[model samples]
Target chain A: MTRIKSDEPTGWFMIFPALAFVGTLILYPAVNSFTLSLHRIYMGLPALGEPFVGIDNYLHLLQDPVARQAFGVTFGFVILSTILEIILGLGIALVIHEHFKGRGWVRAAVLVPWAIPTVVASQMWRFIFNDQYGLANLVLFGDQVSLYVPWLAYPGYAFLAIVFADVWKTASFAGLLILAGLQVIPEDCYDAARIDGANAWQRFWHVTLPLLKPALLTALLFRTIDAFRVFDLVFVMTQGGPGDATQVIQFYGYKTLFTEGQVGYGTSISMAVFATIFILSLFYIRTVGSSLLKRETI
Target chain B: MRYTSKQAWLLGGILLSVMGSLFPFFWFVITSIKSQVRVEAIPPTWFPDWNFSFYQTVFTDHHFLRYIGNSLMVAGSTTVVALILGVPAAYALVRVRMAGKVWILGGLLTVSMFPQIVIVGPVWQMLSTMGGLNTHWGLVLPYVGLTLPLAIWILATFFKELPTELEEAARVDGCTTVQTMLKVMAPLAAPGIFTAAILTFIYAWNEFFLALLLLTDPVKQTLPVGIALFQGEFTMPWGEIAAASVLATLPLVVIVLVFQKGIVSGLSAGAVKS
Candidate 1:
């Protein structure tokens, strides 16, 4: 191996291209977005002047009921969706973890939802919940036409629909993560549990669940961040409609920025989203990620 | 084999997993091939006459092939560039001595978690200014930046696992640093690189938010964006949308079916490593 003296330059050179790509495209734009938040620039009205508003947008965000509701909606989505995803994901992991014929097919089957585009999933669910011709109605009521529920028309049902759709789309991904954790659990633990006269329930409760924490937490971290980034589902399914019921932070930001043309205000919303996720991730890494990393090293 | 209560429970779980996972997409597949009247029937026709009029419309009218071309170009270039930049960087991170290496890796992780909306506004402005918008490279450049973290992380883990003895043996044969990396080390990490490529490709393909903003031109819009904006005014065009959805998703479904082992391992690797 080369000594440190000669190796450093080559190392720096090797990493440069990747660094350049991330730096110029992602980091630079991220910083620029923050700066844009500080000024008042309306894309539709440039003559109004892109003035430096300093903290006015932030002040306005605090008072805006819609903004508050959007944050509330996003956080609610993150909590409810991740919880369901983890529980369902655990079941999927447990089911697929066992030896069975055609297990590869099972694995691929589970990945179908994840493989489908988010927009597609949104549309699929939207159609499924359609009042006139929906699978939900067809399955539940058979030929009863009047019994159909407009799933996306009600704010509460619409929100729940979005959550259900998210869980369906991502649980397999979480299961894959939890399955990795399950794989790392030594078979000896299960063997030992059985020797102690533990039943199936006991073994899973005492052994499997305990060891799956890191993977579960990792899934939680990833899912929470992603749920906060929920836009396409809301955009495609409901357009954040039925009275702003499904307006998650990202969709709201998109509408404000692109549709409403409030550049500074819209960017300010995006900045808040970034900051919230950043802080949440920092918290996650501090609490869960460090332990997971340590376990990986060991 | 004797049927038992436990086995029955396991069988139930398995059935639920399989059916729940496949049913939605399966329904879409069904819808795609059905006649319009059959699709909107109150009871919803369970069987398709295998009418592919929707598919034909999607392919001919919606510029489905063009969307495919655009998606293929963007996703393909992103995959290649992410790897080309990522592998060497990963190798260096694993093999070469550097200052602030941990910080650099941490920064990359943070970048991976960035919300597209946050960077999207400025990125749009930047691309608009640089005349990069409405071009294939416009999407590729940002995608490469975004996917590098996953590629680099996975490749680094693979490169790290390779025994230094192999590199030393190459060195003893009077191979230069570049030569050793290109020849001895890279071949061993092929599986890892392949895994990284699949993940990156899927991501670039499925990504909607960035593609929606960056490529507004109908000729240049990627499949996700195109399919999303396919909603019609008079009718929902559920059949056509279903057809487009199925067509857009068929390639990825094929990829998953063909490469489940690599994808599972690759995704699991992200969980454990990141």
Candidate 2:
């Protein structure tokens, strides 16, 4: 606010607490995780001793079929969930963006799921999909007791159950993001499209879509990054169960690190997770930075 | 006719979206209120019998109130610390001339994008080493760290948007920077700070991963961790778990309902900004 080239010491002083907290807790530990990844350490077998085993854990991660399956699952989960969220989110954004009575209430309604804790949402879905007396079964089979699907027990359905829960929870978030994007588009663009004899779908496809690209990309990137680190859903709903079908990478890391106490191997998985997100965020930053730079030049 | 059909389609979509968003939590709330027999009924009770027995049981038997208190303390402190740190950092990042400002923000962006798995291992170890495990401060320590990036981002955008006149006038009044900041800018930035605090509070309240790792003792665990682990202690504490979930999530739901606009703006601004 003060355009007056104020003293820089106060700037540093004001900023120290946040920097200190992040540095000590996040940046330092992140680096520590890297160093920890280099050594082979087991919590249960301390006598085996902490041995420096460079790249062995990485190699082990590569060979482990469970890790492979986890990645594959993570890949599927990200793709399916992000696609569904974007589609549903677009529908939501389009609907809410229109001038409607009680729009605030509707928007708030959309945010309810986003507001609930992931653990809570996961439990809610688990109950919803419960085989015995679950809402899913009751709604589907009614009094007929035989057809209750053990949704989380079956591998294919189990995966879908988590994805469905995810979509239910987060579609609203994407919707809000897209709505923010939608609010910025000039009304004249649509008016012009209508003047050119463009029908609703045609105008949406031609004009609305192209302009909404950045927003869609923003939503997509955020969703993708979040979906990559999905742990609470898998942990609560499925626990990567019924043949490890839902074992996303983060859950795998958790089990290995905390459950099994293989700290070194676990940290490698953590590194992989970090690397994947890092690369993704770099791509996002490039696109975002280029746009900002473009604005600067203009 | 075409216009009416379009409006109908819009209405249909709007109804579907709202129901889809609200139905799951609404179901949980209903379940939380259902009697034990009614909860287990095959044809699940469509309407609650207005039973809050499960709520009574959880608070009494499961010490659910402790978890809630723990969550409140952790989330509250996390919000305070995040804002205390974030507001000035954001102010500096926005207003003050600092070198390597771009890199600091770039680093903040990277931190925001970081998956918890990346930092969980060492954070766990560090907490364990410091005997911070199972302590509220232990959990708050990392919570503050993880939330700072988004807090700063949101606050920076808010600070950038404030009109310059008040700040300029304060400066011209010969008030020192700190005095002007504390007395002037902060009150003006209250709305932004509140938004940031709400977002941070909700995040810390709902954060399960670090809490799960750092706070293992039942007495020390926050609400999310408690709710997540609610099932293991009983054969099928569905009713109780539902009750706990409802209890755990009620504050957040209220937060969303009341400050929906602020939360949405903060989230989108943080996500979309530099």
Candidate 3:
């Protein structure tokens, strides 16, 4: 009763079509982005007529105020959102760790936000925050604070609004990943903690927290990286409005290339994004890559 | 060891967390049904008189139906293409370990991470040149490219985990490679395929940037683009937008609920464990 005789060459041919498809879509786009980032172009009537300008675009971009501010906002959003998500995510995962009825339903319901598209969620929340008819303003501030404050219209609140939406949509993602980590902990460690008279908090702190490190780190890595690339939500919510408050690095990069028709400059902005993500990913890979890899594979 | 005070605290934490999570959704649903004045009223109304006016308006006011149909077509087509292309690729990577496979996989991951803006320029030019702009195929082609790598990796990992004996037996019984894949392996890998389908559907459904860049015609717009067009200065009818968003999300929500297992497995499977 043997199965799948190892006829490897046929298998190779079968996968080649997919390889070519990805190459055109993914690989080429990535490389193309870098190439354009290095070139300078002139925005004309319709088509972009351009000449080459090597690192000039990047050098100018490095000193660009708009680009720098977007970078700052992006860093702030990613760091803040990742921290909140991990904390809240871990808290939720711990609670679900208990034996309870309707737990499955609860878990599924919590994931609803995570599953919804960012655009939909952002729009939903944007409407909710609408100063005139928004639920948030009506409920939280009311007409007393002047419902005309336009939550998305103000810079600070705009950034806050985007973060709020992101946190709502993604915290469950952190929870699920952390929950998977919780499942992997050996039952005996908790049993030992109980026998030692450790309180619930003590047991969690000394036992669960350490055990869940890999999952925590993994969630952090994914969420943080995603935060840096945050575009759709912000794009939909504010389009980096109210004087560039909500604008993140990605949005700025995109505008430079597409909206402004500065291909070279836009590419540089994107290159900066790539470089930013690359550095952050390196630190993550260096720190928890091995541990996360082991846990995931095994 | 036995259950103690810690268990009670744990339960309390769970309750609070659940409340935190479910409140916004509850709020959104309630708000969606409320009148504009009630929705905008101070201290907010927790409950609303049931009204379908917003839904009615959303349906009548914009090209909601067209947008939804576009979404379905694009998502459905992408799912079909991703499955056709990704399944075999995944199998090949798993079974053959073909040369440059690692590079191929790496390339896929990079694209998945590639911001939509970067490629939209060239892709738009390419699609327009091919006369695909604003058509369903333009969106579908990019989606297939976007999702195939992920689908392949996920399916390949699942395929790798299957017992090799079933396929070997089929081969010994004179089943050709395609026959073995179709008859023997496909059935066994149903769960993984479901995961891939659900995932592909989600990406296609939620996709915004490419849809925004490529599909410019309001009548031909996808759901995301259609909703975005509703955003305007002077007035953005909250009730209408909410209604449309709720409607747009209904299919996705239903899909997520019905395919909860597949959703989770798809997300986790696509990510790691290779």
Candidate 4:
């Protein structure tokens, strides 16, 4: 807690080993990806045979229709899912903000889906959404449920299925964040609102919402960033299949690298993801990061 | 305090939401034990036949024990390595004000963010060259990279929250930095360390894509990847798959339940703060 001179060396020597691990493992691969993106590939020694062909991959990515569609889906997925999670999270957080009986159990239960492995949840929901034997149609549509609606086998429905699972799993995450926000709100404000005869809705709008902004933004940014790079559930559930309808940029990048063996091409897609996310962080930094740092410190 | 009808309705809605959330796992357990005939039946059996046979089949044929062992090894190794490496880095970053903390954090976060597919190719190539492919180390090392940055950040936050006077006093007493860290700081921050360890373990244990790509040997694969092999491209072994899944997930479920507060706190730490 001591305030020292700003110029004083904090003796950060201890961090170098950890820093080195990240630099070598993560940054090197990321930089390698960027380098690969700029190079042309030929199958040869070291596997990623290359001569530098600057910006070709980027240009090709820009022009490729499939890549474009995947980009659209990625954007759609991030924006739509993040927005929905935030809204629902805020609503649910408000409902659970106060003290109640069995609150601890309810709180733990809400996190169960979040704790489950992404692949397991995907498989579970896959069967549930199965047109033939799945419970979704049965529960939602009664015995007259048709056995032909392939949830993962179709294009649009496949996308819907991915989004449904993502939202269902993560909205509670948003809720948890907002609940933390709610917990931090001083109770006196609510007491004051009641003394002023504010209705529940009015109190929420005037009191809770304003106080919850930082946490809301934190949850939104976290969800936004996470959603942008989503790969697991989609990969396991559909493998970007049914003619790549559910394919997002991440999966597309993955396919290019691993499945096609076009290292350079895959690297280009990967770099694009890195750059896009970096840009997002910058944008988030401009708006919410400061507030987050301030609030977290307090 | 008095209850209004509106408040009561809100409580009901919240309760219903929580119940709806838990309904899937309820179904998962019920279905896992159901007979394959019942599992595939049109109407869907609401309750399982109370048969231990599915559990028997899973443990007997599927190398279920090996998968659990692999999971424990990968997850356990990941937890240990990340803590050993991350705690010092976190201390240095927060206490020493490390020069590249931001870039390091950024890079680590990026790795965490990138889909496993993006790096799996190059990583596979690299590991194969090192003869790590199909080894537990292959998965464990990547799992460390996967969890390290977040663990460092979480611990850094805890470190920052810590009052530095004790460390200062230890230093003034001629205690070395390592000694101060071990003697004064580590014990005080046990909860934070536990939080990091548990979360890292869960993440590594639950990880599928990396395990799938690197560990191609059926006998060598971890539980998640092992479970995937049971359901081939041609055939769907419903009973066996469900049973394996139930077993694969039990450790995580148990850990989450036992350390619910720590896990939740860590997740909230990540989500609500950064």
Top candidate (lDDT): 1
The true-versus-predicted C-alpha distance at residue B150 of model 4, in Å, is: 0.7
Displacement of the residue A169 alpha carbon in candidate 3, Å: 0.7
Off by over 4 Å in 4: A3-10, A42-49, A145-148, A290-298, B97-118, B232-234, B270-274
State the displacement of the C-alpha of residue B207, model 2, in Å, after optimal TM-score superposition.
0.7
**lDDT for B65 (candidate 4):** 87
DockQ of 2: 0.76
Docking class of 4: medium
In model 1, which regions exceed 4 Å deviation?
A1-6, A289-298, B1-3
Q: What DockQ does each prediction reach against the true complex?
A: 0.71, 0.76, 0.52, 0.49
Q: Write the per-residue lDDT of candidate 3 for residues B82-183, one digit (tens) a residue.
A: 999888878767666346877777666655666666676667667878999989998898889888877887787788889987777787799878787889
Model 4 lDDT, residue A51, Cα: 80
lDDT of 2 by residue, B102-207 (tens): 8899799888878888888888888888989889999899899999998998888888888878877888888777877788888988888899999899899899
Chain A TM-score of model 1 versus the true structure? Answer: 0.95
Query: TM-scores of the models, in the given order?
Result: 0.96, 0.96, 0.92, 0.92
What DockQ does predicted model 4 obtain? 0.49
List ranges where model 3 is wrong by over 4 Å: A1-5, A43-48, A141-149, A192-199, A292-298, B1-7, B36-44, B97-103, B231-234, B270-274
lDDT of each: 0.89, 0.88, 0.78, 0.76
- Rank candidates, lDDT, best first: 1, 2, 3, 4
Sequence-dependent TM-score of model 2: 0.96
**Least accurate 10 contiguous residues by lDDT in model 2 chain A:** A289-298
